[model samples]
Target: MAPAGSAACVFCRIVAGEAPAYRVHEDGAVVAFLDQRPLFPGHTLVVPRTHLETLTDLPEESVGPYFTAVRRLTGAVERAMEADGSLVAGNNRVSQSVPHLHTHVVPRRRKDGLRGFFWPRGHYADETEARRIAARIRAQL
Candidate 1:
């Protein structure tokens, strides 16, 4: 695990509010926010507050709480986006854009065009749009 104060880690900076993020849910244990590059309109990333590099590095006692938050966020995301279902996934190391342990909760719909592992990212039209989506997700929580 990297130090919580690791200045080089972007996710750490986001958690510290040093970097900008549209955070939807935050608690003592975790933070859930809109993904800047979203797989879908309501894509979100749920991250632990601590700077654990990967899911394997997260403490055993933290696993349940960590996933519990992920589960709750998944439902909120799907409902907020009016999607049929969601994809809750985490990368231990491979394909992980940020080193910090975070889960991707992506809202899914039939014929939504997501295929296999090829993720086509999208962006919010503006900050206002991001904030609106974030607010909707927050409301569902």
Candidate 2:
């Protein structure tokens, strides 16, 4: 169900076809579209079809599927934009200008000059190494 105040939300209007968007993909639960003010070309935002004020507001059952769409779009964006990788991020409340739960999948290339957010990024040496890290998280979960 759409949250209260969705009618005033720009993203909600876009989802409802009341606003314009360069749509990339849409499913029963989510929509992917190009950001009008992209961090880089091919930067896309994946949002739930239902109105949600933030990630914390999204129903727990929808979390996995929402991120699944994000994961799929991340790969597509990278391939379509010829990017080396992608930077996937979401703001809960503080940096969330839209107030709707959305994920940013920004195409990235090495040494693209994006830096200094206090969080340093690194890569796993290979799939095996990455899997090990995943296992650690799974263990905790």
Candidate 3:
């Protein structure tokens, strides 16, 4: 499990109340919030309270409830957005953007034009610049 001081992570900000989010569901164990940069209208993210870099790192017991929340969120997204299909995916490889674990529950339509999660990457000049961005966002959390 990652400690609260893991400053270089986005999910930590949401968990810490330092950042704002369109929170749809929350509990002692997990939080489901709308994705800021969404693939679809009702795209949401299900994240555990405890930070785990990858699915393999989280305790086996947590998988059930985590996915349970995902299913529930998907149902809500479907009704609210009237989506035809849905896609919930997690990454263990390069597809994973933030290292801290998060599952994206994307509400899909018939012609969303989204083939997969592909976004271009831009690098910062140095660690100082990255820290500045992280700190600024953390303060807003």
TM-score of 3: 0.76
Please estimate how well model 1 matches the true structure, expressed as its whole-model Cα lDDT. 0.90
The candidate that wins on lDDT is: 1
Stretches of candidate 3 above 4 Å error? 116-141
Give residue 12's lDDT in candidate 2 (0 to 100): 89
Put down candidate 1 lDDT per residue, 18-136, tens digits, no spaces.
Answer: 99999999988898999999989989999988998888788999988898999899989999999999888889888998889899999999898987566678889999999999999
**For candidate 2, lDDT tens digit of each residue in 1-141?**
346436778888888888899999999779899999998999999999888878878898999889899999999999999999989999988878888889999999889888735377888999999999999999998
Candidates' C-alpha lDDT: 0.90, 0.89, 0.84
The lDDT ranking, best first, is: 1, 2, 3
Per-residue lDDT over 1-141 for candidate 3, one digit per residue giving the tens place of the 0 to 100 score: 446536677788888777788899998778889988998788998888888888888798998888888888888988898998788888874678777788888888877898754777689999999999999999997
Count of steric clashes across candidates, in order: 0, 0, 4
Which regions in candidate 1 have their CA more than 4 angstroms from the true location?
117-141
